[model samples]
Target: MQDHASPAIGISDLPAREEGYVDLRSYAAIGDGRTVALIAHDGSVDWYPMPNLDSPPVFARLLDSENGGCFELHPAQAHSATREYIPGTNVLQTTYQTGTGKVRVTDSLNTGKSGRLPWGEFARRIDGLEGTMELHWRVAPGTRLNRVSPWADSTRQCPLLRVGDVTLGVIGCAGEELNFSDRTVSGTITVEAGKHRLIALISTRHEPLPCPDPEHILDGIERTVSYWKSWSSELHYDGPWSGEVLRSALALKVLTHSHSGAIAAAATTSLPEDPSGGKNWDYRFAWIRDAAYTLHALIRFGEREEVHSAVSWLLRMIRKQGPDPEVFSTLAGELPHSEHEVDAPGWRGIGPVIEGNRVGGQLQLGVYGDLFDMIDLYLEGGNVIDQPTARLLADIADRTCDVWHQRDAGIWELTEARHYTSSKMGCWHALECAVRLAEAGQIEGEAARWQTERDRIKQWILQNCWSHERQSYVWYAGSNTLDASVLIHAMSGFDRSERMSTTIDAVQQELGDGPLIYRYTGMQREEGAFVACSFWMVAALAEVGRKAEAERLMAQLVPLANDVGLYAEMIHPEDNRFLGNLPQGLSHLALMTAALTLIEKY
Candidate 1:
């Protein structure tokens, strides 16, 4: 309920780092839809990936502090600092106050006049407010990630630097004019009142380099801010927690690729879920389940263009690849064929820092349900599908009936495959939606067989998955394990009776850590609380006619996000530190679904 415009705590001495690495909680994300950069509270842009969100980093101090590259600017020694998003926008402003004066550093990824990023352009503008403030800045493109040394040529029109395959045009680089031996740039400046300076970086992958003048670079910063504000203004929800909802929408927007409309799971990858060591994952790839959830959320906010782009991209890739779609893909719809434990040390020395996701080949029965649910929502939103898409959905529905009984990785993507209760519910939900589509003549399929199979799934779950002693659905058929993922079925209209109502309380009692909920019963020891599970429970509670309880839980979970309202894939329950990849798309998507579910009832 606190205003995001108000600073969370007073501006104190800037955060200190441990072994050259700041806490994951200290990072906030800025992007131009394609590239996302993580700027820490200490004024360091630590994790920046050029070309796209899933690409290798240009500045990777987030992974390896010692040798990883970074774009940094801050007070030379000691300065107090506070940070916030420029209201209703992804542009970040950091205030630095030293003994002599105050200054603000505004950061953003520059977009074109058409309000889209055609290539990578990073703009950092410094403006002086009070007396003279001395600041230091650096541009070091580290080579540890891809194992290629950086090369620079000061002889070019602009200082040109190449890190791996990408070439960078460093404009307004403030270092000495003839300094190119070290392949890095560093400078110091004294800003008196009313003084301003600019540092812009333009990068290209395989194409010719871009030329951006100082005046246009400054103008690009304002233009990017304008684009973000205009995008946020189109959302039309004014219910309770609307401020937090809008921030979540903006965060999801940061994860949504403007060109392809495929939303990455998170901004950065290999941030450990278990801070002490293992369980690091590369979540930058676009998963079908996550994108489907994103589609559902954006539809609720009446987002048209993003929704259309995502739907088109998903179907095009699926049709091209076949009805049994691959689990995840690149932003450009390519199936990822490469994954590696890269050379860099991980955040806080968590080893085996990875680049691409390794779990894409796993069989997850829930994906069919996610796909159909998204298609159903898209149709209900008053859109028409082509004949090919309709036939594709029908083919997928037939395949779902064949594979629903197979033991596979559940929604949690755990290694031990089983007949997960939620997985069956997902299949059932998919078939049920297919039946409705067939009844409405949307998708051509065996409506009668789908209906029959849906009933069989319902009966099987009732007979084998229910636990008489616990009065709740089990995680799998034989075990009594509690899973928060089953709560998702409530919103899908799987169950709305006394059994589901009782199961909600039982899962909360077993999985809840106040407002935070573990993914399953025994997961508290392995990782932090899963962020999306808590929001899924809120929707389940509201769906089963427990409005007051849902509201109370919603109130608690809304403020649990970071100061700028971005969430990690998980949150440490004890210290509230971020765990897993940051600015997770599923967390924000779940937040929107929970809020819309609550608003629809009122």
Candidate 2:
């Protein structure tokens, strides 16, 4: 409620870190399935993708430090910080220790017990830990993907704004104002031990402010905490790394889209992995590969409802393509027709924060494998696949038979056309899962022909995709290049034999960095160690009966998570800074899969 545009200590006068940069892993993220909040270690919400997962960020200080608006709550002085989510929930508690005192900031995005929400609300509670400490606050609403700079106004009671049909109100609980702009606000406050303050950002597009009393906020906080505790209590993980597993479950829960059951790749888009490399890409959409892995994680954790919701979303997304096939869509289930850069400067010089994904139009053959496997998994659980969905599956499988030999954009969605062997193997995976599904009475398909097609695809891959000289599978048919994606075959049951174990070791030596691994060579410096590849390596290790190695590798990955137990698309092992989008669905889902695989096997 208190705004301090001017800091009492003038830290704002200091220039921000250079562009194309961030204090890597400085923030933890929390979400309510509808929207996500990024909380910095120093207790600032530097970025939030608002209204929807794919919407332009309204608060985007992470992208533009000086002009972009952010909400911060940290100790008055320079402080040391460590934070984590409450046991198994998305509520993050960050503790800051200053020369004078210590303080704790609990950050959460309010959600209902039924895994639903009245609307999206990001709430922060500040509790003094020792002597008095100073806290700062700022709110700057940005255009989605950091495009438009909307105006902000305070009318004594609330910070109100009108943009199109959207109406927003920012309310503070224990502070007063510093400065208010048509598009930004900042302030500072003092607090002592045993005292507390609260702040809430509420969105109301067509409705009244529904202004609740401060007492009501206190009540909401207690209720929300209790609900998350009860929900997480249902998890069944009991392993050597139960703590990491629980954290992964909580992160996956935060990424879940309550209304549609879709889980986004990450909360924000186009945050570069290598700040100096210009390797930025938007990750605010859903991928079928992530959905399949996320469902398994939810199921392993006994979150049947979330699993069901994710399945429904997957079905709806695929069903919308109407028995024909295309790449996946945004979490809202809309196709990404194209991509273009916004006019704004990149986050710390990471240029061209892209909007929309042209990859949606490319033939990502791997998607077919992910989809059929998800459907097979759902059926194996004794869940019924609807007739329409079954029909769609068969049609897609038939199409895979027709197109299995074609080149694709590849799993990384690279722009060039290449004979990506993993893409063809993905076709094999689809046909294999389809045959199994038909045998299990899940669909009506040409089971014999599909089986024959599956065998033929395998034969083709064995002859063309493998590199005899390297004694391992390569990225494509003719090249000796290695891709981390081939590790999935060993884990996906496409090949769990001795050859896979050798390939796994080869991948470790060739592409693995410490326990983290890359998808492939920079291939022109477009990527870092793809985080999901590392998880695939973890799962593959477990499947090949290398339990201890898998656990050790898994241990290495847990620390890579930011304080809130979230992961991006990739990581630089040397520096351990998260690259790509925050809380990426593939990364988190892969983490979940690796955890479950270790628990189930070891």
Candidate 3:
């Protein structure tokens, strides 16, 4: 093991900022399948939650730059920075170039023999590539930043930072004597050419402080990188935009809960869809719609193991927790509760940072379509569905038939429930997919009854949703508003006629901002365009036999992804800046699906 006795250095002034915030696009994420850390271009770990993704953040400077905690390691002088992931892995490398020298910093959340380390370990390795550079480093454990009282205590071997039930051990420093003040530990050191250093923060909850072994920590980094590369190598996509597809797959994998097989809608929450506060909501929990789409994308790439685990988990959740399950749930399959505000200021001073989602109680009819489509895709991929799951699937199809005419939240989960055209179309899709499955002998269902209901729903949508005045399907009955969600009908195989193609043109005329599409009629005026909607348009175009147009629009849409090939929930049309949650599963899933469609068309 490497030495741990090097003395710490005194604290230095916190890094200065232009606006005290980094653009969401300027950050890359690293994770160990349990929790993720957001590292900015300037080498600051500004957002991280210890132990788990849903836990309160220990380093939240991304929210409250002045008071929230962060771990920053950067050159003392000014420098231009660039970053990338180690190929096929989540391990991130950031390079800084100054007037006289250059340095590279590698960051990773270490993985162990079984998988993610039971105890949290964040390791950073810095190497001087040329000349010499002075690096300033700090570990400011915000202790959830005043959520609880935190203090530092000196142990016989090293100092420990304690907050509530968790203890953080800081080790592998090679600076001056370490100083702990104001709930922060920091130091400065000089690294010359051909020299290097390592630092780590190991955390354990309600457990004894474990010694940090530097050599073992270094080995963990190699193992973690190898683990990610091995996983990436197993992916089977050989289609158009293969790199982007693989990156999306990797991002979706990062958001998955290793133990429960649940995938979060996004990695970070309360990052606003609109810079103005109200649109911000927590997305750390699993939504059935999002999970279904994620599984669909994975299944397209022949990711059997992940698909099976996720399907099994969902079936178990449905069997135990459903007749009608909540729109969203915890990774462990329990329904999420009400939304509440966190104490931290939201990103860029937007207030009322939220902790939970409020839409859990709403009725979204589209979920049945999503679930049945996921099951259909899995079965088509030669996977077997358990008897109980098949029964549940049949029951859900029947329920969709029973509820197709009812008013419920649409695909957007709008608070005002209505007879959304998309919801009815989804019901139609559920029944149709069920009929097909029953015909294939993949499941036991009332195929004749399902077909009858499916035809009824199709007729209902045609009669009520079509707007002759607008020459397209309206967002809902009696409203002239156009919703991008109707684009899903083309992908769902609801309509391949000339009317569907005309509807696509009308949707683009009203809701499209070139390649970026809005979720609904008026969202572009208030907030960013929904990223997934653009990809949905790509799928719809290809489905309508406009392959060249689909490829052209896709070419525009792919460039909007951030440097690391990850997408947020929305994008500012004018600035092209990312908005809302980072590493959004829906956005990535849409991208993957669009790529699959384009490849098939070509």
Best by lDDT: 1
Candidate 3's TM-score: 0.95
Candidate 1 error regions (>4 Å) = 1-15, 144-146, 173-181
Model 3, which residues run further than 4 Å from truth? 1-19, 143-145
Better of 2 and 3 by lDDT: 3
Clash tally, candidates in order = 0, 24, 4
Query: Candidate 3, residues 199-281: lDDT per residue as tens digits?
Result: 78899887887876788988888899889888887788777777788888888888888888888888887888877777888
> Which 10-residue window of candidate 1 scores lowest in summed lDDT?
1-10
For residue 203, model 2's alpha carbon misses the true position, in angstroms, by 2.5
Winning candidate number (TM-score): 1
**TM-scores for all candidates?**
0.96, 0.91, 0.95
lDDT of 2: 0.73
What lDDT does candidate 2 reach at residue 99?
82
Q: Assess each prediction's global lDDT (C-alpha) against the native.
A: 0.86, 0.73, 0.83
User: For model 1, which pairs clash?
Assistant: none
lDDT of 2 by residue, 1-602 (tens): 01111111212222334542356466578777677878665566777766776766666777766656566666657777666666556677767778887787778777654655676677777788899888777666656444454777666677665443455676664347567777666678677899987777777555666565665665666667777777777777666656666666677777777788877777776787765746677777777777777786676566677778889988888877864456667777878758887766667756777777667678788888878877777777768878888888889888888888788888878888887988888889899988888887888878888998899999988888777677788888888888888888876787888778888888898888788887886532555688888988999999999888998898887777664556777787767767778777778778778878887885
- lDDT score, candidate 3: 0.83
